[model samples]
Target: MNNLDKVKKIVIEKPLKLDCGKTISNFPLAYETYGKLNEKKDNAILAFHALTGDQFVTGINPITNKNGWWSYLVGPDKPVDTNKFFVICANVIGGCIGSYGPNTIDPITKKKLATNFPVITINDMVNAQINLIDFFKIDKLFSVMGGSMGGMQVLQFVANFPNRTKTAIPIACTASHSAQNIALNELGRQAIMADVNWNKGDYLNSECSPDKGLSVARMAAHITYLSKKGLQEKFGRKLQERDDLKFSFDADFQIESYLRHQGSVFVDRFDANSYLYITRAMDYFDLVKQYNGNLSNAFKESKAKFFIISFTSDWLYPTSENKEIVIALNAAGANVGFIEINSDKGHDSFLLDVPEFLKSIKNFLDANYKIL
Candidate 1:
């Protein structure tokens, strides 16, 4: 974050009225790009990142010093094949990294926005990124793709700007946040607020953070990203570097240790307030409601090709939910494809090295790119 200025970004001089009834201008949308935009600029792909993801989609993230969140799928000769197409990814508004959010100091106030930042929605996030397209002077994008929260943006993008992209891939996402998911997100938000150090989202003013609460929230959310079967096979009742269980409350099971590690690392790179805000945005997402309860109507005007994908083990956003999108697209008479990949990796399957899933994406993009 100290080197945020090094990241690529564009300051939108045009005013963007957020769904929360607030207007903002001269805001930054931090982004990163890979490969080259061809002469026609038709080979560019706009990739949206999920919750906790940043502009780094592939290669080593300069901030985290780790591989990009979608490294497996976006590098040269990989599924997204950056070698053949230019890829652009941005840190969404209401996100912590470089983008305008709770951690960003308000230029006028000279203080962190914290809880004062306007509550943003998925629609607002997509609209902010549209500035990037205009900045690049791109007439249209070759493709738009993402998974989980990112996938949600993909659907919202195509629906909002039907003619802006040639193809759209929304993997392991839903048109509306299910009650169950909303509850899970609430649990995470509550965990953050419960921390005494949170101090009503003013922790930064006191030179402290709700790291403990944020860690617990991450641990809980990480479980939903993995399948039950995957957990059993990978961790199960295996002890963590011991022959017998500790008699105390310390992590005894390997699964417990894994989750704890996940939580700990997450708190280091992510902001608690950003987590709260983004989850709220996800819960408020209801494309169906926006279209008057007719999910098909959301895409009725979109001519972009859509490919919906789901994982066999993803109970978070199950095949059934994904099928709903496909069904809506079909009812709208849109050109769309659907695939329920066989994987034990749950909702995180799209981020992992699932050969079948990777192959499908490669084939879809390659075939479609040839058409262009």
Candidate 2:
């Protein structure tokens, strides 16, 4: 079998019993692996993907026919250094890319889940990943690293299975979803559901899917992923492919064109209903709540060395939020390091080519872990 076929073959059906009290039987989780897990399984690194990301972490994506999202940091000689560590990136539950999600058929109903899918949470996603790890027979992960929504998963994993991780890194994430963040996600959901073409979440069987609404939602969320300064630097009143402005509703600025392209391309590979479920899951995430509303208590049992990173311009989950994580780790008496990198890339900085971030990660791993 080819690489894609191998990946497909590894999918585990009925990964877990979701938090919603629903059993997702015969589910599939797509993942990609690099390097080999040593006999001791000490070289394994679990890399989680952010919202809109998939299992294609270090190599080209066969399905989308595009380059891997984080190839810059996870190559043969890069910071993740596939040559030394066994890296595994799995599509989170409620994800559309070969994973159980709203698009998955309900065996009992004999129909696609659509809007009938159970509401999932970050805890659910982390729990499913733990199952996968157990299936692989990995007693412990060398590290768990991620950014944004992925970072939230990292936090959830550490909180839920403190003994399973040797090191935990959560970059550009919050301990819980802020009210403002929840509002933003709710607005996006509203936009998608409001579209007449949505057909009350049954757009899959409709003549035309809710592309316009989904595109608008993507455009809005994409703005939060970028920094104001970055946007200004890249496209400050610049004309769109034309010297003269149309004065019409057409995309007049370069930023508008860029956002349009992002939205259009996103809808082609993503399911609108899946987007709703996953974003809602993120909005409902609160790691502290599980520990009696005390963030520090959540980490009290964690023995992993923690590295919490934040970008200066990431307003979505500002430096303040990362500091909150640091404070909790400190209170828990966990070995922790915190860094706020100077960057104008917003929450997307962790995924982008940031030299300082890469350097810090490399140095931290080198000093602490035995990289084979």
Candidate 3:
């Protein structure tokens, strides 16, 4: 393959420290890049993926045959404009795609780690990202952006490597995982564990996949991504096909059918154990609590210009939480711009085609991230 068409992969063969007191070796990360790095190598943008997201950010997903998740905003002439900036996105650690995760082979046992893989925290994922950045010989990122769990990673990156990023955009996220967030994740985990097919996370050797369990988990979590208003507008007591109820145990309403479809399709491209590990990593994320419960102290050293967005209808990561981060940044004396986007798209507004959100992102990048 030509240099421009290269598929990027990085291997950390040496032991790396983790916040959980465990050291990992031979950690592999699969990433994708768009545009090109210039002579100065300072035009790179690092994008972090959400819980179930992989490395494909702006290309056709080989397995799903669908456009990249954020293709609307990351391509040439788009909001961030890949034609102007070199964009890099890696599948986070504890993810199933081409990256190190619970389903991968363990060098020591010569078998898939399955349930044996050591638990990882969000900080550990950022540490792995640092290695990938170092391998590419990039000293500073032009910008870093993401939403939901992706947003959490962006916050951690700016906090940990303050001066390394010129700008930070974290949408629909908080500086730390709220107690309600942990509860929601726990609900999904329970649904997975309750499925008999899970077989205690050892389904790999048994040659039996936990499709039902994983599907149920995805179904439960998908509901949290939308707002009550959005849900009502989309499928409020609407019947599936016929006007009358089936009077059976099958999907009776439109909402039920949608959730089932989401669950089934998710299991096709995602692993059950990987979901467990990733959600666990998110649940353990609490930046302020980690720094003695002081929000100001958490972002005191951040030098990146901040632009935070939140949806008015997003109950998962409400507008209030987004402003809390901005308030702390203000106290820390960080350059910041924030707006509460008026949208009914809920926490998934950042992923949807919201004109206001797009305009705001484009204007922010144009102002803060200058491409020369």
Tens-place lDDT per residue, model 3, 115-228, is 888899888888788887887799888899999989999988887888788899999998888899999899888888888878889887776788888898899888989888
- Candidate 1: tens digits of C-alpha lDDT, residues 1-372: 567779888888999999989999988899999999999999999999998899999999998899999988998988888889999999999998888889889778888999999999999999999999989999899999999999999999999999899999999999999999999999999999999999899897786899999999999999999999999999889999989977998998989999999999998899999999999999999999999999999998988999899999999999999999999999999999999999999889999999999999999999998885
Candidate 1 weakest lDDT stretch, 10 residues: 1-10
* C-alpha RMSD values across all candidates: 0.8, 2.3, 2.8
lDDT agreement with native, every candidate: 0.93, 0.86, 0.86
User: What is the alpha-carbon lDDT of model 3 when measured against the actual structure?
Assistant: 0.86
Model 2 bad stretches (over 4 Å): 1-15
Model 2 lDDT tens row, 242-352: 999898999998999999999999888777888899899999898888778899988889889999999999999999988999998898898899999999988899988
- Consecutive 10-residue window with the lowest summed lDDT within model 3: 1-10
The local distance difference test score of model 2 is 0.86
Candidate 1: where are CA atoms >4 Å away? none
